[model samples]
Structure formats: structure tokens, C-alpha cells
Target: MQWIECRVHTTHAAHELIAQLFITHGANGTVLEDSRGKDFTPEPWTDIIGKPKTEHLPTDGVVVKAYFPDDGTLEATLSAVKKDLVQLEVTTNQPVAQTEILLTTVHEEDWAEAWKAYYKPVQVSETMSIVPTWESYEKRREDEHVITMDPGMAFGTGTHETTLLCLQALEHIVNDGDTVIDVGTGSGILSIAAAKLGAKAVHAVDLDPLAVQVAKENSEANNVSERITIEQRDLLSESSNEQKADIVVANLLAHLVIALAPDIHRHLKVGGKLVVSGIIKQKEQEVIDVLKQENFQIDDVLEQKDWVAIRCRLTEVGGE
Candidate 1:
């Protein structure tokens, strides 16, 4: 099968939003390349094949490449994606570095395993690490927790800064025997990590069916399927009034996080913590304002690159 690869040239600040735009327009997966040289770290024993020369790396911006089926709607989807990118730039008051969209044809056989070369074991936090199923990573310590996952087409593989920040927060927040609610649990990474951290039960929910399915598979692969309940539901929509959790983690877009603030507060116990990510540094204040309005007390703020993750607690009275 042939696929249409749409590459967007943008800065690190705008890469996440641009990739999300592509995903919303029917792209299955996205590969991000930045000039920071972070993605070029290769394993020692692995032989380099078809690796790009240092000069080929972009020096000024990031390239986000997303794959879509070569169907008749490819052009329309690309047009919509580009329009959304432009609108995003205008709304955020930040340019995308380059407005031109690059297109290429990729054969299924050639592109299937190409991305695996870039996915190595990532140590996201002190106690947690994300290991791709195909990668061999020796545990560095006795207390280290390794989460084995293959993201497939879903998100949250622990590579993105948002995911890393969320994982780091979870490392400290998820207590043993506590109940955890993971909103938009892509690839079930957070849910699995929660379970591995000794959470009594984990409820993982996502609006996208593909994400729910991928999360289920990943949970099983990580041996946490029995502890996690994966469902295709919007954030806190299907949650019952009695279904309060000890911890609620949401690694969703900033706008979605703001919209779900009230529901998140409702679904958590009186003093439950809410760990939220996927927030750009520029829009961090907007999200913080909404969270405060919803009576969530800000606890700790974790920032990586241009992204920010907030760990807040739902106040008992939920007000001033």
C-alpha cells in the first residue's frame, strides 16, 4: 500500500499542535524531527542503516511528518490540515517557521519499520521508564519500573515532553492502593504506569475508539490489563457521581483540559490530585486560570521545552 506523507515545517513550540492538526485530519501516525539533536541518540550495539547525515538535519525548525492513506480525500485532508495550522498560528500569535507543506509518497513496506529506529528506551522519571517492546533496555536499578509499550497509531509513547512530564508527575502522585482515572489515555501508558506503581484500580477513558483499543493492547502487553478498565468514553462523561478517584491524570490539549476542568473536579475525591499536560508554555496561564476557577489548587508545575504539566489538587470546598 502507498501512503501520503504530509510533512509540516514548524518550530518546536508549534510541533505538537501541528501534529495534532494532522491527526485530526485522519493521519494514522506522526514522526517529529527537531534540530535539537535529541532524536538522533542511537543505541551502541545497533548498526545505523539509512541514517541521515548531520547536515541534513534542520537547523532552525522541526519537521512533523504524518501518514495518511492515499485515498481520494488526501488532498482535501491536507488542505484542511494546512488551514488549521494557519489558524493556529494566528490564534497563538506565533509563526510556524514555514508555511509550505511538503508531500511525499511512501510504500507500506518501506515505511512500516522505519520509525522503530528512532524509538529507544526513554527514562521519563526517577522510578519509571518507557521501553519500546522491540528495544532491549537493562534496568539500571532495583526500584526502576519499566513500561513496555508499542504505541502503534495512538499517542503517548513517552517521547513527547507532555507525556514525560505527566509520567514524572504520576511517579510521585500515584500511591499504592489508590484509584486512578486516566482521561484520554492514549496507548494506556499512564494507566499501566499507575497500575505498575501499585494502584488498586485504573479507569482509562478516551473519546477515540482507536486510542481505547491501542490502550487496551498496551495495558495487556505491560501485564496491567486486569488492573485497568479501558473504555471509549469522553472525559468524565460516563463517570458516575459515586466513582470518585484518588488521582486523575489528563494529558490532553489545553483547550480540552479547560473544558473538562469542571468534570475533572467532579470526578475526583475531595483532595484528589489532577495531573494535566499537553499545555504549551504560552497558554499555561489560560489553563491555570480555568483550573483555579474550578477550585483546583495548583501544587506543582513541570515544564519541558515549550510544554508545561500542572499537578493540582481539587480543594475540599472547591471555592474561595
Candidate 2:
């Protein structure tokens, strides 16, 4: 089996976003190379393939390398990726340091196992940790909430700055017997955490079919499938006449957050909590402004690295 490696050179700020773009185009795995990677701590594959070369990484930028199966859609996928990268730059005002999308052909064994080294037991908050299915982790504390995850082709590890921020915000807001809605629920990590935190029921929705499937599997793996319903739906569309939720969580980009803000009140009960994450540093204020316009009262603001998550409460129902 062969694979086409799409290597993108971009600023550290855009590295994660670019990797996400590749995933949206069907890249099964991604490896982000940057100065911060020194702490990756490779183990199993290190002895087999030797330590990954870190010294040769671009001095001024991060390299996001993604692997797509060379099973005949390379031309179309590559074109789509390029087009999206351009739109991303315009949509979010994200600076693209390099435009050349470098491609390299390699064997399946080259990356199939290497990327697993990237995921480890990451304690997203004081009470919760994301442990990959391929890893062995004992509870740090008796009450520690362990979420078993294997994102597969869906492309989230629950450890990115945006995800970490959302996890923390959920910890502060989710309550027992509360109904929750998670929009753009990649890998269903947030939904699972909400269930563990006592949310009576969770409706997790994502537009990506792969994400929907992966999330359902993760939910079942964490033993919270009974409480969480995973489905593929676009939250950007009109909301259905379903039961209002006590809380809503969206770990999506800033533009989507802005576009989805007005409709959020529909899914949430009056004064219900809203946990929003995945906003890049540059667009934080833009998202805040949008939320405020929709009658959301900022309850808390969480920031880490270049990402921010806002916890808000629906002040009052504007209308039905």
C-alpha cells in the first residue's frame, strides 16, 4: 500500500488548522512538526523506525504532514485542499506563511504506526483525561474521568489547545440530569465528557460522516453510548423543534462559531450554559462580539496557547 504525504509549511498559529483541513479532505493521519514537539516522547515505534528527525524542521515555521491513501482520489483531494487553504486565509484572516503544497509519495508502513506516538494520556482538566485506546493508563485519582478515544480518520486527539479549553469549560458548566448539545462534535470527546460529568443525555452532531462514526465508537468505548446519541447533521441549518438543552458545546472554528451563534439560543434553554471553543487568537474578539449580540452573557473565558474557549449563559430568550 502506498500513501501520498501532503506536507504544508505554515506558521505555528495555523499548523493545527491546516492539519484539520487535510483531515477534512480524507487524510487518515497527520503529524505536526514544530519546536514544541520535543516533548512528544516516542516509545514503541522509536526502536523500530528510529527517532524522528527534529533538527531538520523548518526554522521559522511549523510543518503539518498528512497522509492520504494513494487509492485514486489524490488529484481531486489535493485540489480541494488547496482551494480550502485559500478560503481559510480569507475567512478567518489567518496568515499563510507558505503557499506551496508539497507532496511526497511513501509506503503505508512509513506512517501507519508512527502517528500513534503522538497521542498519550493527556489530562485535559483536573477531573478528566483522554487516553487513547492503544495506551494503558491507570486513574490518577479515584474520581478521575477517563475517556477512551481513537480518533482514526476523524483527526482529533482531544489534546489540542482548543479541545483542552472546551474540556475545561465543560467541567465548569455541565450538571447532573442536564440535556446537552454538542455541535461539530469531532470524535465526540466533549459529548463523552459531558456524560461523565453527569449530563443525563447528549446529542452529538457533526457534518463529517467519518467524525460521526468515530464519535459513536468513542462514545461506546467510554461506556457513555447509552447517554449520548451520535448523528451526522449540520447545525448551521435551521434547528428542529426538539427539547431545549441545559448546555451546548461547540469546538469549532471562529467563523463557524460566529455563523452558528444566533441559532444557538434555539438549542439551549433560557440561561443555559454554552461552551464554545476552537477560536484562534486573532478571531477571539470577533466571536465574543457575535455571542454578545445574541444575548449571551459571558460567564467565563478560558485561553491556552493560541486558542480560546468562552463559557456563556443565554441571558434571556430573544424570541421563540
The estimated TM-scores of all candidates read: 0.86, 0.83
Best by lDDT: 1
Best by TM-score: 1
Q: After the best TM-score superposition of candidate 2, give how far the Cα of residue 16 lies from its true spot, in angstroms.
A: 5.8
lDDT of 2 at 88: 89
lDDT of 2 at 152: 64
Q: Write the per-residue lDDT of candidate 1 for residues 1-320, one digit (tens) a residue.
A: 78888877788778877887887887877777678753555333223323433454577688888888888898778778777877997999989748588889988766547647556676667777778788777887899888998756435356667887898898888889999999988778889999999998999888777788888888888888988998888678775425789999999889999988977756888888999998989889999999999888999999877789999998867483
RMSD of 1: 4.2
Deviating ranges (above 4 Å) for candidate 2: 1-3, 13-31, 37-59, 80-99, 104-112, 236-241, 318-320
Candidate 1 ranges beyond 4 A from true positions: 37-57, 85-99, 107-109, 154-156, 239-242, 318-320
